[model samples]
Target: MIGSGPALAADGASTETAPAEDVTIVVTGEKQDRTLQQTPSSVAVATGRTIVDQNLISVYDVLDRMANVVVNGNRTSFSIRGIDASNVLGGGDGALASVYLDGAVLPKAALVTGPLDLTDIAQVEVFRGPQSTVQGRNALAGAVIIRTADPSYDWSGRARLLLADKTGERRASAAIGGPIVDGQIAFRLAGEIARSDGLVRNVNAGGDADRRKSETLRGKLLFTPAAVPGLRVVATYMHDRHRRGGLYVELQPPYAPEDRVSTSDLIDVTEVKSDIATLDIGYDLGSGLTLKAVGNYSHIRSHYAYDPDHSADPGQIAVIDDPNKTYQQELRLNVDWNWLQGLIGAYYLRDDNRGYFFGATQNLSLRRLGVDQSLLKLGLPQATVDTVINLYGSGVPIVNSLDQPRVTQNHAAFADFTVPITTRLRLRAGLRYDRESQRRGIDQRVAIDKPLPDPAAYPGLGPIIGQINGLLQATAAAATSYQPERTVRYHAWLPKIGLSYDVMRDMTLSLTARRGYRAGGSGLNQQRGQVFVFNPEFTWNYELALRSAWFDRRLTFNANLYRIDWKDQQVSVQLTPGSAFDKQVINAGRSRLYGLEAEFSARPTATISLGWGAGYSRTKFTDFDVGIGQVLQSAAGNEFPNAPRWTLFGSVTWQHPSGLFANINARYRSAFYQSALVQTHRDIRPLTLANAKLGWQGEHLGAFLIVSNIFNVEKPVTSALDPDGRLRGMVSEPRVMGLSFEGRF
Candidate 1:
C-alpha cells in the first residue's frame, strides 16, 4: 500500500482474514502485478475503501494527504517532490507528470477542467520519481494511475448520499455489478452527481463566486468466452461534466478570512465535458506467460469566461474554449520465470488540441514599457508628459482573438526486467526508445480598444499627439494577427537500473537510477509575431529506499531518499523586460533537488490503527539567469515556487465492536514561495488542516458525520499582487460539516 496503513476490505468492512501485517497489496502502476514489498519503485497506493473511510471526494483530496506531493490552489497543476507538473521549465507544451484514468491518458486540459471525482474506484497509485522507461514521454517527474472497479461473478451494489452545511454541498452516488452469464460475462455501472454553493461569496454579485456542479457516469463489460478458457476481455466507457465558478477573490481592506468574500461584478465560470472509452484484452498462454493489448480514446471540451479586471464596473471579460482528443494503443507480453521476470511492450498515441480565445482586457506590460521616460528624453514638456502618463499609465484596453491548434503523435518500444542474482538479491533494468512529432499553429489578432485622443482639443499639442498616436499604432501593429505553423520532432533513449536486497525476512533495501525525459516543442511569441522552438529536457534521479515490517507483522515502515539533477531545462524567457508577450520557452536553466520521505503504520490492536507520513525537500536552481523587469538577474539559489520544504500528515482510526467507528486525520505544509520571482511578499504562509469522521457501520447500511477543516484555517493557497497594488489570491476552503449515508447489498 502507498501509506502501508490499515486498509479495510473491498466491501468497506473490517478484514478478518489475517493480521494487518499479513495483508498483501498488488501494485500495477509498472505495467505488471507485484506485491507492494516486491516492487522497488517509490509509489503510494490508496484503495477504494480508504477513499470512502476518509471522505476523499476527489483525486486532489487524496494528493493532499500524501507525503512529498503538492497540488496548486488552482487545481490546474501539481508537483511531486520538488518538481512541478506544468511550470518546472517555467511554461511548456508538455506536463512533467501524467494522470491516467483506467487505461486512458487524460488530456492536459482535462487535468484542469474535467471532474476527477472519486466514485466506484478500485485503486489509485502515485509513482513519485521518474517513470520514463515504462511510461515514456511526459514522465519526467511521475505519474498517477487510477483503476475503477470491474464486474464480478457475484451480484453487488453500493450507494451513498451526502449533505454539507454553509456551502450547501450535496452528492449522490451509486454503483452496481452482476454476472450476465453464470461463467462467461459480467457488467458494472456507476454514476455520481454533486453540487455545492462553494465557499467564496460574491458580495457584489449577490451569490457564491465559486459554485460548482459535477456529473459522472461509467460502465464496464467483462467477457470470458467459455470456448477460449485462456482469453479475457474488458471494455469500459465513462462520461464526466464539471462546472465551477472562479478560483480567485479580491483581497482588500476589511478582509475577513471566515467570510471568504469576493467583490467581482461578474462571477467567472468554467465548464468541462469529457468522454472516454477503453478496451483491454489478455490471454494467458501456459507456463507463466501472458499477452495483453489495450486501446483507449478520449475527448474533452472546456469553456471558460472570467472578469479580467476584478472590479465592479462592466470593464472587460475574457473567454476561452478548448477541445482536445486523444487515442492510444499498447501491446505487451509478460514473462514470469524462476530465473527472471519482465515485460516487453510497444505503444502508440495521437493527441489533437484546438483552442480559441476572445477577450478585451487591460495590457499592463504595454503600460510599463517606459513610454513616458522616452517622451521626456525627447524634450517634451513636463505637462505634456504628465498628460500622456495619465492617459495610459493605468493600461490601455485591447481586443484580442486567438486560435491555436496542436497535434502530436508518439511511438515507442520498451522493455523492463528483474533478474534474481541470489536468493536475497535482485537486479532490475529497463530501457525505452521514444519518438514524438508535434505540429502546432497559431492565429492571433490584436487591436487597441480605446480611440486616440483628438489633438484639436488642445492647442500646440498636435506634434505630441501625433507622436503618441504613432507609438500606440506601432504597438498594436506589433501585436497584430500572426499566423504560423511549425512541426518539431524529438527522439530519446530512456533507461533505468536498480537493485534490491532482502536484508532480513521482513526487511528490504533498494537503490535505483533512472533517466527522465520530456519531448521538445514550439511556442509563439505574440509580441514578436514569431515562432520559437525549445529543446528537450532531461533529469537523472538516484534513489535509495527501505521497507520493513515489525512487531509480529503489525507495524510497517518505509522510507525513500532521492536526489535529482536536471539540465537543459526549458525555462520561459522574456526577451524584453516588462513585456509578458515577449516571452518564449528556452533551454537555459539547470537545477538540483533532494528529498526524504518516510511513512509508518501500526495496528496496535485489532480495532485501532495509526499512520503517519513526513517529507522534507531542498530545491534550488544551480544555474539560471533571466530577465526580471529591466535588468538581468540570477535565480541560482532560489527555491522553486510552491515547493514546500516540509510536509506532514497523520491519521488514526478506531472501530468498535458495537458497530461504531471514528477517524481523524491532519495535514501540514510549511511556508513556501508562491512565485518563481521569490519576493518576500509573495511567500505563502504555512497551513494546517484537520478532518474527522464519526460513523456507524452495519452489514448493509452506514451513516457518518464528517467535519472538514475543523478549525476553519483559512490561508491563501495562491497569492499575487493585483494591478491595483492590492494583495489578491485564492484562499483555502473554510470549515464544512456534513452528513453521509451509505448502503451496500
Candidate 2:
C-alpha cells in the first residue's frame, strides 16, 4: 500500500501478498534481497504505495522523489551526487549520508527533523554511490533504507485521514496486524498524528512563524517458536515527538518584496524527542547456512531557538541544546553454496553527543560605535536614538555560551561475494575494515559583567555611558574560552567491485568501483581561539550501469554513469564575522563529480501507468581557498552547495474499473548555489513541481483529492547572509490542497 502516489497499487498497498511477492522490488543495495535486475548499486525504491501517492511526509519528502537526491536545510542537510552528509551548520565526524530504519542506525539528532513515520512503511531504499562496502563510516554519502510492516499471518488493518490547505494541515494514521500465534506469533501496530499551520509570518510574534507538531509510535514483534528449531525473532519499538516554530524568514531588503513577514521579538521554538529500539535474530544453519543478529538503541532530544539577529529585538536569542545517544551491534553470516553467494559481517558503534550553545549578544556595537550617528550628532532623533538603544540594550546581561561533548567509536568487518562465471558471466566483491574513534569536549563562555547603568538615568550620558561600557568590556575580554580534549584514530580499507554481462535477452551490463571515507576530528575554532585537528576525507567512485527490458515486460529501463574524486574536503571556515561562535574546521577542499542517472517504467495499458527519473550533475570546485571574513576568496570554481545541476521526475497513473482514479507527479530542478561563497544573490532559483491525485475507489473504501504546488513555485528552500548584510530566505511550499481518507480491514 505504499500510498500517497507512485502507481503501483493505486492505493491498495498491495505487494501481491504471498511473502509480499518475495520482496517486491527487492535490491536492498546488496545487503541481499536481489531483484531490480539483480542489484549492482545506483538504487532507489519507494513504496508504501509510493509513500502514499507521493505525499511523502518528510525525510525531505523522500529526498524529493529520489534520483540523485538532495534535501538541503528545510529538513536540514542531504546530498548524493554532490556527495554531502555533513555540515548542516558544521561540526562533524560522521554521517555522509546514512540513515536506516529497520536496520536501525539513525541519531545524529535524528538527522535534524522528521518523525520518520510513513504509517506502516515498507520499503524506501536509496543507495547511490559509495556505501563503503555495506555502510561503514556512515556510508560516505550514500544510504537510506527504511522498511517496516512485517508481522501478519492473516488479520490486518489500516486507517488514515488527512486534510490540508496551504499550510494548515492535520493528519491521523493507524495500522494493525495480527496472527498472535497463527504462524507462530506475530503482531504489529502503528500510530501517527501530525499538525501544521506553518509557513512563517511572524510580524512581531503575533502568530505563526513556522508552526508544526508531530507524533508517532510504532511496535512490532514476530517470532517463530515451537520449541525453536530454526529460530527467528524480530522486535522493534519507536517513539517520536516534534514541535516546531522557528527559522522564520523576511529580510529581503528590510521587508517588502511582498514581505512574507518575520520580525520575531520573541516566539521562537523547536523541540524534539525520539527513542528507538530494535532486535532481530535468525538462525538456520542447515546446509545452505544463515545466521543473523542485530541490536540497536537510539535516543535523541533537541531544543532549538532562533532569531539571532533577525530581530525586532527582544535582544538577539539563539539557543540549541541537543542530547543524543546511540548504540548498535550486528553479526551476520549467510551462504547459499553451489556457484556461491555469500555475506559475513560484524559491526559495532557507539555514539553520544551532548551539546549546548546559548546566546544573546549582538548589539554589533551599535554599528561599530557610530552610535546612531552619535545620536544624530547629539540632537537625538531617529526615534530618540531608538529609544535610547532599546532602553539600554534590553536590560543588558549579554551572554554567549557553548559546551559540547562528542564521542564515537566504531569497529567493523564486512565481506560480500557472489559468483557464477558461466551462465552469462557474473561476479561481485565487497570488503570493509573500519576502525574509528573520536572524542571531543569543549566549553566556551562569555558574559558581559553585570548591573551597571545608572548614570542617574542618563542625565547627559556620562561620556556615552563610558563609551558603551568600554565597548562591553572589550567584547567580554576577547570571549570564547576553551577546555579542549581530543582523541582521533581512524582506519579504513573499503573496497567493492562488480561485473555483469548478459546484455541481450532483456539486457544487463554493469561495472562498479567504490571507496569512500570521512573521519577526522577535534574542533572548537571559536574564531581561531584554536584547538583544531582535521584530516580524513576521501572518495573514489566510478560506475556504469544499465538494466533494460522492453515490450514483453511492458517496458522498463535504467541507466547510471558516474565519477567522483574528492579528497581532503572538510571546509567550514568563517572566522569572526561578528562573533557568536565564528567557525573554523578546515581541511581545505578539492572536488570533482560527474553524474547521470536515468530510469523509466511503463505499462501502457490495463489502465495506464508510467514513471521516469533523471539526474545530471557536475559539482565543481577543485581546490578551495578559505578565510571568509576578511577575504581570502578563491573557491575554485564554486558550485557545490546544495549541488543541483539537473533532476527531473515524472509519474502518471490512471485506474478505472468503475472506481475512477488518476495520479500525476512532476518535479524538475536545475539552479543551485547557496553557499561555498558565490553570491549571485545566493543563487537557488530553478524550480518546478506538480502533484495531483483524484480518486474514488472502493473495496474497503478510499477517497483522495490532493494537489500540491501545482504551479505556485516560490523556490528558495533556504538561504542566508545575516551578520548584518541581511538577505534572508526560506521558501517553498506555496500551494497545497488536500483531502484523503482510506480504510481497510
Q: Per-residue lDDT for 339 in model 2?
A: 89
Q: Per-residue CA lDDT of candidate 1, range 530-642, in tens?
A: 77788898999999999888987688788899999989888887775555567788777788999988887777887888878888998888886544432324567778888
* Candidate 1 deviant stretches above 4 angstroms: 1-22, 355-365, 368-387, 455-468, 625-632
Candidate 1 lDDT at 319 equals 86
lDDT by residue (tens digit), candidate 2, 1-745:
1122232221123331222112236555456666675675788777766665565776567777767787774666678886666652253556777888888877656666746666777767788777887778767778888777777667777777989986888989888888888878888888889998876788776888878888898888889888888888878888988887765477475664235677767777778888888988888878988898888887878888776767675667778887778889989788878788878999998888856454555444453334455566768677756656655653446676778788888899999888889798788888899888888778777676466566567777666666666655665555566776677788888888888888788788888888888777777665334577777778888888888878775666778898888777777765544344456667777788888888777767766667788889888777765645424356677667777888888878777768687788887877777766654643777887888878876667788888887877765676676545567767776778889887777
Measured with C-alpha atoms, the lDDT of residue 172 in candidate 2 is 90
Quote the lDDT for 439 in model 1: 86
lDDT of 2 at 546: 86
C-alpha RMSD values across all candidates: 2.7, 22.5
What RMSD value applies to candidate 2? 22.5
